[model samples]
Target: MRQSQNGGKRVLIVGGAGYLGSILSRKLLSNGFKVKVLDVLMYGREPIEEMLAHDAFELVEGDMRNISTLVKAIERVDQVVNLAAIVGDPACTLKPADTIETNFLANRALAEACKYNQINRFVYASTCSVYGMMEGDEKLTEESSLNPVSLYARSKVQAEEGILSLEDENFSPTILRMSTLYGYSPRMRFDLVVNTMTKNAVIDKKIFVHGGGKQWRPLLNVEDAAEAYMRVLQEPLKNVKGQTFNVGSEEQNYQILDIAKAVKESVPNAKLIVEGEEKDLRNYFVSFSKIEKTLEFKAVKQLKDSIFRIKKAIEDNRFSNINDPKYYNVEIG
Candidate 1:
């Protein structure tokens, strides 16, 4: 039987030092789950540095692609949350080979390891980017056809297919197709849509709306994303196992121009600049009915809240230098 309470359970959060992982790790620890993070720490360890003091938290500094390292990380873990990936399109495009190796191949291997080790509850992080381009104001759902337009999205689709194929009575995996994430994190990233706009508005007093500013995106706060994961982890295995949830609220969806305008509203003096003509092909908004109906999960934070919160963080000089390459995934790649 699976552990009902978080107190004694062990969870291995692969890539636990990344933006979303950083928040999730802290939440799991506070709720009494022992978290063992296996990450290359390619960015740095500062995101999880404070976690080292907690006796329940453990960090295994290594690459997920390394089979030996993966095996070692899952030694006694009860559940696994796989979040390691070459996150953005630009980053994945810059390094296609690394992207496939890390995002798809390594993820399959980890799921296989978990399956064989009797870790039935595996939560995989997918993205709504799988719905590449939707026309006619249609809202894509979990059952919608995937039209991945980039290597990053394609890798996630393939990984989801491969991981779900491993599901059975003894090994059930849940896929959380997360929306574009924003807001502050210990390992801050300015490359995402909302964060980038907010950061540019705060620093340069300008917000750029590329691709004609009409592309639609479903935004989710980092804290809310972590809550979705925790909800799945806490729910009974029968409820979440072998399920794919689009993790975001319906009302949070907005177009590029609107997002830029919101950031401009927060910054007040920032100028909104429109550039190019529909360069980006990704423009699909998603439906969150499935997750809401099943897990009773609804994203609490709104885009305006995220914009103001991030703006305040920037105004307070929370980040030493937002221009640092570490803040942009593509730049790091």
Candidate 2:
């Protein structure tokens, strides 16, 4: 049985120093969990360096691909949240070999390790991009056929299958198919749609929309994404075991043009320019009803709120250099 929201519930958050992971680490620590972050910190250590002072926080700086590292990291862990990956389409394409090793093979090994170590809950972070380029107005559910067009999405699909195959009475794995994340994190990213658009509008004075910006995308606040993981961890094994939940509200889905307009609204003088064919093959809306129905998880942050929040962050210079390679997964990968 799970600890049921008690203190001293130790968690190993793989890639916990990355964008979304950084946000989650802070949350878990605040909630009284002994948070262990196993990350290469590929970007840098500054994102989570402050947490080093917290008694409840521990940072295991190592590669997830290393079995010895996994063995050490999972020690005394009650839950495992796998958030490490190549992250986006371009990053996977840029480093195909690395993507395969990290996203698929390494994840499979991690899930197996969790099972071996008797870790009660293993939550895997997946993407809504797995529902790539669906037809019509259908909001893709967990049961919907996946049409992954990019190597990134393909790796997640393969990894999800691999992780789920290990689920049994001892090991419970819950998959979260997260929407495209926005808003700010301690370890920030401007590569995502809202962040990118808001950054461009503020810094570049212009916003670029590709393929006329008509693709449907579900957006989730980075903070809300963190909350979903917390909720899943608190729930009993029987409720979330071997389950996959889409983690964004249905109303949060929007066309790219709508995203651009929001950025324009936030950044007063920004000009919007549409260009090119939809070079990116990803276009799909997701349904969050399953998570809402099962765990009462509904994303509270709105798209406009994310846009303005990012805009405010930039104006305050909370993050520096919009073109910094650190902000871009593909460039850094």
Candidate 3:
């Protein structure tokens, strides 16, 4: 294969058939990196079905928690990106044991395996929800104290700590505390705030705003999130190694009510409703300066753009059934 910007480096993405992983794997392969995906295919193979034919793409169907499977997958791979997890608040709550085992324990095991295999460069996918909630208008940074409110966030926090603890001179690990993601993916997710709102506006013709719609959330497109991973992997190790960066644009932060309004604006016939005064405890925005300055990474997709894109995809019948169990993590996971 002709060389691309990534210099044909082989990188293994654990759980690479999930929503974010599927997108990231495609991005890596398109940019000249040989991509090896290790996934149990919990959501099924359709997300990666088209890519199976790509010369640079290789799929290893196995569980990341199995030591033997992980060890074999890491062979001949230069770096590893861990994106394997139960992945959302409700989903994690439903399967607490699996969440802990996959998100936290499996992550630690993955780190140990990478270290043992001498794969020094590792990028771990973490979530900005680790901040939980912040007082006033404060925008939480990587240095801010964590107050994870959900089992999902807590598991990710524990995994981040566990992986970072394994960092040494020979093992370079970088943690990316990503903002809540939206936009369309092969493995679409309607569980997220933005996507849920957009789906509601498109299907139900109404968007519900709970907790007085005052909670703050930072949103990033699935594509932008994938780009951030590519940037980190392509950059010099000294710049990203042993570092934690929140991945999102400063301009993408929006109040819950405002997100509903944006979706309504995209689908003009949709009505917006406010339900209950009880706020969502997991309310926080994040700072992306660390990544912007260090890796020169900035999310290019706007919230309105994603809303419109999703709306168009829905209108185009890209998904025969928008209510599929596979589109929702809580439903299928």
Candidate 4:
């Protein structure tokens, strides 16, 4: 592919300091893409601090709620990936207004700005939580009805609609309904299920299972999630435009207990403490056939590899304090 500007590919990732974005920016920059990250630095700059020295990487510290910020960020860019938002259910519940503005409103505005700027490829990071909890045993596809059980999922549902509403011949907006992300990222987070369990297995010697450990959750490694985005960025417009693909593998779906057990197996000595009550309502086995069939994209990273990455990061003392607020999305102001 020909580079967009300065003989290199120029792409803007709105939330490029988050868990997945941190890994993604590195991948793009390594491939000679002139990467620009626009974030409020809610987490901190350390996730991407190493990238600051790269000649092809640029950081625009700003919020996605600002229209002018997005307009300036996307100007003359080949692709725009929107990973910015109040990500996760608890985080959204804690800040409903902020979630609405960022997840739904600003997301819609960003898509419009991309279209207006004549940027054809727009990737909106959605979640499979949109299919909140299905009653059936069969796996849900992109065509399945979205039963968003939380404010986080609901906001993404609306954002998906609003962005797709702007889709036309000129603007190719692709929505990736991503599965639950786990594994190590430069912008590390212990809030995710696999990451948390693995960390606890190594450090605390016990992993807490909030639910009965039977709730189904589809898993996708952060690296694999990044790869899915990269594939969409490279695919032909007709193949991906105005389409929604579940970014995960059906084989990766595992019950909560299964995930915890995987951690126990890896750590060997950690015990799984299963609680009687299950609170978080999301449970669904996702079908990633659409993305695999269309773009030839399937999650390549193994589930165990993800667990090992988090475990190794912890053993290496990557985070000064695991309980630090910077590691969570909701803890920030």
Instruction: Estimate TM-scores for all models.
Output: 0.97, 0.96, 0.96, 0.95
State how far residue 191 of model 2 sits from its true place (Å).
Answer: 0.7
RMSD of each: 1.8, 1.8, 2.3, 2.4
Task: Kindly give the stretch of ten consecutive residues in candidate 1 with the minimal lDDT sum.
Answer: 1-10
Ranked candidates (lDDT, high to low): 1, 2, 3, 4
Candidate 2, residue 162: the lDDT equals 97
- Give the per-residue lDDT digits (tens) of candidate 3, residues 103-218: 99989999988987789999999998899978777779999999999999999999998889988888999999988899999998888999999988899899999899888888
> TM-score for model 2?
0.96
**Model 1 clash tally, residue pairs:** 0
List clashing residue pairs in candidate 1: none
Q: What lDDT is reached at residue 289 by model 1?
A: 97
Superposition error at 166 for model 4 (Å)? 0.6
Question: Pairing residues by index, what is the TM-score of model 1?
Answer: 0.97
Kindly list the per-residue Cα lDDT of model 1 for residues 158-208, writing each as its tens digit. Answer: 999999999999899999999999988988999999998898898989899
Q: Summarize candidate 2's per-residue lDDT along 187-256 as a digit string, tens digits.
A: 8888888998898899989999999898899998999999999999888779999999999989989899
- Each model's lDDT comes to 0.91, 0.90, 0.89, 0.88
